[model samples]
Target: MTDKIVESEAPLTLVGGGWADRALLADLRRHAPGIVAADGGAGLVLASGEMPLAVIGDMDSLDDAARARIDPARLHRIAEQESTDFDKALRSVAAPLILGAGFMGARRDHELANFNALVRHPHRRCVLVGMDELVTLAPPDLTIDLHPGTRVSLFPMRALHGWSEGLHWPIDGLDFAPDARVGTSNVATGPVRLRFAAPGMLLILPRDALDPLVRTLLATPGAWPAP
Candidate 1:
């Protein structure tokens, strides 16, 4: 957005308009280091005394106060009303992995929209970081190291079948659908392995899995299967 293309090849942390506490902001900055705001999220970034690389959105919610604090060079206004601010930011940026915060704790509709945006941009890997949980699209093959008895939830945005290993309850042959069936509250017996039949399967794990999951996503090669 800022004529400034992100030259860094590292993953980026995208801050959204939800409930980003100072602690969460600090943690994201520590790991991803590069921050970008989606419209109203600029206020949160400005409050942290740090400027985002660019603010990409419709520019409807961006107030003058927040705008004044940011350098004009960093403001990017898409002006289209077709998509949510999260979608605008995701499409505008090019990064191998994206860690999003302040996107899950707000209104239910907003949270749902954010998830839809993630699935729409399957080529761009992302993990939605919340206070108590982490949500990410299940890659074709995912191996995660978790202690025994850890909670793992699988929510489907579309109908799909999958197979799993080292789980208290296997996901083999299960038809997962958003409106019909879903996998949730499954426990891990040991390290977990999953193979998805299709994209749109979201893996919800404990918040502690954030860093490890991001690492795994970045290490994986190729884009997700085309929708």
Candidate 2:
């Protein structure tokens, strides 16, 4: 989507390091066509009974035996010690949507770094599928749908115009800033929908109930602003 070095996977599945997010893992397992392992994520893939299509990253976490177990052609063992393996994997593919698992269970610093990747790669249709919820960064005025009971959360990356509808308490006119603004955590009052008048916001939700959520979000249309 960004004209970068992304290989088309149409429906790609990215593997991260959060082992206990089974609900999210289950959802990704059901939906992803192929898997991309970030560093040591191959264990999750193997444990899940799915061989990875490609393993991209710095090769720090993988043992020689583990590396031997994976198909060599599928391994894109990037040795760039300067960046996180996650970032290396992100640059390697283009999928209409990339569903990732296991990215937030490590150190807080790693977790925050992964979070940064989500927003920075907004040019591609990607979603960081995780335990307890999902995350995606989008330009202002994006709409999202959630399963009737699915919980949703929104965090602003910056201060900008906020106009919302469908939340228990919708904001028609407001300015939200990352340092001092309150985000909206609400339920779907007849299918969640909202629009903003600026750029950049983080979206989160409770796991796979997003089938309907995605359906509702795309029921509108969109433009790509970043990657």
Candidate 3:
């Protein structure tokens, strides 16, 4: 990773290549003005009529046409296979919150990599937006006001322990392992509270919960645990 950090005064949006929808980009940009694309995502950002602050990735998926459109100074090529474009952009950008679009819904592997990126860099607070779900790395401690019956699924990227209240299935006293047991399809009985004993928990909630989650992430005050 480069020593230079791309800091944003406001929340940032990461446009990826799994799937690009013009309307989705516009909506996300409304909240996150600073936009950064992940390789091929530059093409989608251009198609949406918005210029990205920078396009960061390995540069393999970036076609000549897309490269020609992006300012040379804004095009950052990491050219490393050990990490994906999503990883490159997330680690490079510094923002209070990051909302990622076009990173989910197309390929399962690509989506999974994006999730891996989220877990790998716990310091980056990013949420991946899909058609129907919003995935984010669960903070060390989180509290959200939600209506009863709202879906609050927790998927562990690594084995960890945590406690929760106001959920149909309490996460308390549960041994969570990535490959062994996952907490999915849990329902929120009311306003929910979560205290993660460690990092590596992934929080999946309904798409409509995106805005509230973003606000919660910003209002909460604490630095992420070291990876």
lDDT, each prediction: 0.85, 0.68, 0.89
lDDT of 1 by residue, 1-227 (tens): 45433535888889988978778988876668899999999999889888999998888888999999889889888988888898888878877788898898888898999899888987778888889899888888888888899999999998899999999999998898999989999999988999987789889999888777777787776568545
Please, what are the lDDT tens digits per residue for candidate 2 over residues 1-227? 36433465455778876543445556765655666788788877777777877788877787777788887877777776766777778867876667777776557787777777766666655667655667776544555554465566778776766666677767667677788775767666656666666556777776666575555434446745653
lDDT of 3 at 112: 89
| Stronger candidate by lDDT (1 vs 3) | 3
* Clashing residue pair totals per candidate (backbone < 3 A): 0, 7, 0
RMSD (CA, Å), candidate 2 to true, equals 2.9
User: Model 1: how far is 17 from its true place, Å?
Assistant: 1.1
lDDT of 2 at 204: 73
Q: Could you give candidate 3's per-residue lDDT for residues 117-220 as a string of tens digits?
A: 99899988898998888999999888888889899999999999899989999989999998988999999999899888777999999988988888888988
Arrange candidates, best lDDT first: 3, 1, 2
Which is the better candidate, 1 or 3, if ranked by TM-score?
3
TM-score versus the correct structure, for each prediction: 0.94, 0.84, 0.96
Positional deviation of residue 120's Cα in model 2 after best superposition, in angstroms: 0.9
Residue 34's lDDT within candidate 1 is 91
**lDDT value, candidate 3, whole model:** 0.89
A best-first ranking of the candidates according to their TM-score comes to 3, 1, 2
- Report the number of the highest-TM-score candidate: 3
Better of 2 and 3 by TM-score: 3
